[model samples]
Target chain A: MKARVTVTLKSGVLDPQGQAIAGSLKSLGFANVGLVRQGKTFDLTLDETDPERARAAVADMCEKLLANTVIENYAIEITA
Target chain B: MKARVTVTLKSGVLDPQGQAIAGSLKSLGFANVGLVRQGKTFDLTLDETDPERARAAVADMCEKLLANTVIENYAIEITA
Candidate 1:
């Protein structure tokens, strides 16, 4: 099974990296750019054979070690 | 308008960060875990009022600044 996980900062958190990218874009003449928030993505190939178990385990993995739940949100997409 | 962009390393590229994470997971007793690849995500609120133009411009921004084309791939999701 394959899984894709995305972890993003919750709203109202200051994203210095995103802000720096936005500033660089503006300096490079990208007028259309505005606010930017940076996040993380994970692609994993699980050893699990059971689809339901794999999904649950991956979600647990995200919550436990992959994301900071207090200030971040995560979503998982699974493919078999 | 809001956009979410996901950037990932292409297959065959070495991801040391992901390997370290996976090693940590194994050490912490996550037996179901296997291969892990680390990537990046971006969330932005574009200044443009036009939705179509905003999408195009943001895609360009990813291509130009957010992702490394040689070994990375990106995807965008837009919400109004």
Candidate 2:
């Protein structure tokens, strides 16, 4: 199986990297650019004899180390 | 308009961060977890009086700053 995981800073968190990128965009004549929030993305290949168990396991993985629960939120999608 | 940009390491690029995460997952009983590749995700709000121009501009932004062409590939999606 294959899975995609996205982890993002929660609303109201300061995203310095995002801000810098947005500023750079504005300077580059991308006047249409507004706010930008940066996050992390991961794609994984897994042993998927059973998807349900894998999903739960991956979610646990996210909570444990993939994301900082106090300031970040994560989502996972599974595909074969 | 709202845009989601995903930037990923090109295939064959070494992804040390992803390898570390996968190792952590395995330690946490996510034995199903296999190879992992890590990337970046961005969510942006843009002034989209016209989407076509905005998309082109965002792509340029990606090419110029958000992603490194030598090792990364990016995809952008627009949502209003």
Candidate 3:
């Protein structure tokens, strides 16, 4: 099975990387750009075939290592 | 309009960060892990209301800044 985990900063946390990107865009003459938030995406191929078990394992991975729960949030997407 | 951009390294590229993650998972006793790849995700709020225009602008941003077309690929997903 294939699973995708996305880790994003919480709303209240400051994202300097996103701000830098936005500023660079503004300098590049992109006036339509507004708030930019950046995150991490992990694509994992697991030996597990069961979608339910895969989701659970991926969720556990996110909690244990992939994400910092205090400042970030994680979502797991699983495909068979 | 809100758009999400996901940037990922092309297959066959060496991803040290991903390797480190995978190694860490293995050290943590996750034997089911196969291959792991890491990517970047951007949540962009645009001033443009039209979805088509938003996607085009986002694509431009990706090509010009967000992604290195040489070794990386970016996907623009527009919602709303």
Candidate 4:
């Protein structure tokens, strides 16, 4: 099975890295760029075959380690 | 308009960060985890309204700055 997890900062949270990227973009001539928020993606190859079990397991992983729920949000996708 | 860019390491590329995360997961009791690869997601709010133009511009950004084409691939999605 394969699972994908996307972890993004919650709205209203300050993202210094994103801001820096935006500034760089402007300097690089992409002045039309607005807010740029950076996040993370995790691609996982799992041994579990069952789709339901895989999703549940990956969801647990997201909650436990893949994401910091206080200031970040996560979305999971699983494929068998 | 909003655009999303997902940047991932190409196959066969060494990802030390992903390896470290996998190690942490194993220590955290996720023994079932297999190959774990980490990537990046960029959420961009663009002033451009035309979907085609937004996609093109973001693609250029990815090619030039958001991703290293030598060892990474990027996918772009634009939403109006």
**First chain TM-score, candidate 2:** 0.95
Model 2, span A8-77: residue lDDT tens: 9999999999999899888888887889999999898888867787788778878888899999999999
Writing each residue's lDDT as its tens digit, candidate 2 over B1-80 gives 89899999999999999899889888887777789999999999998867787788789889988999999999999887
Candidate 3 CAPRI level: high
Tell me the TM-score of each prediction against the true structure.
0.91, 0.95, 0.98, 0.97
The fnat scores of all predictions, in order, read: 0.86, 0.93, 0.91, 0.89
Candidate 3 lDDT over A32-76, as tens digits, reads 899999999999999998999999988889988999999999999
Q: In candidate 4, list every pair of residues with a backbone clash.
A: none
**Model 4 misplaced regions, further than 4 Å:** none
Q: Give residue A59's lDDT in candidate 4 (0 to 100).
A: 86
For candidate 1, the per-residue lDDT at A65 reads 93
Pick by DockQ: which candidate is best? 3
| Superposition error at A63 for model 3 (Å) | 0.8
The true-versus-predicted C-alpha distance at residue B25 of model 4, in Å, is 1.1
**Over 4 Å off in model 2, which ranges?**
none
Candidate 3 regions exceeding 4 Å error are: none
- lDDT per residue as tens, model 1, A1-80: 89888899999988999999989889877877788899998888888778889889888887789999999999888899
Candidate 4 has an fnat equal to 0.89
User: Which one wins on TM-score?
Assistant: 3
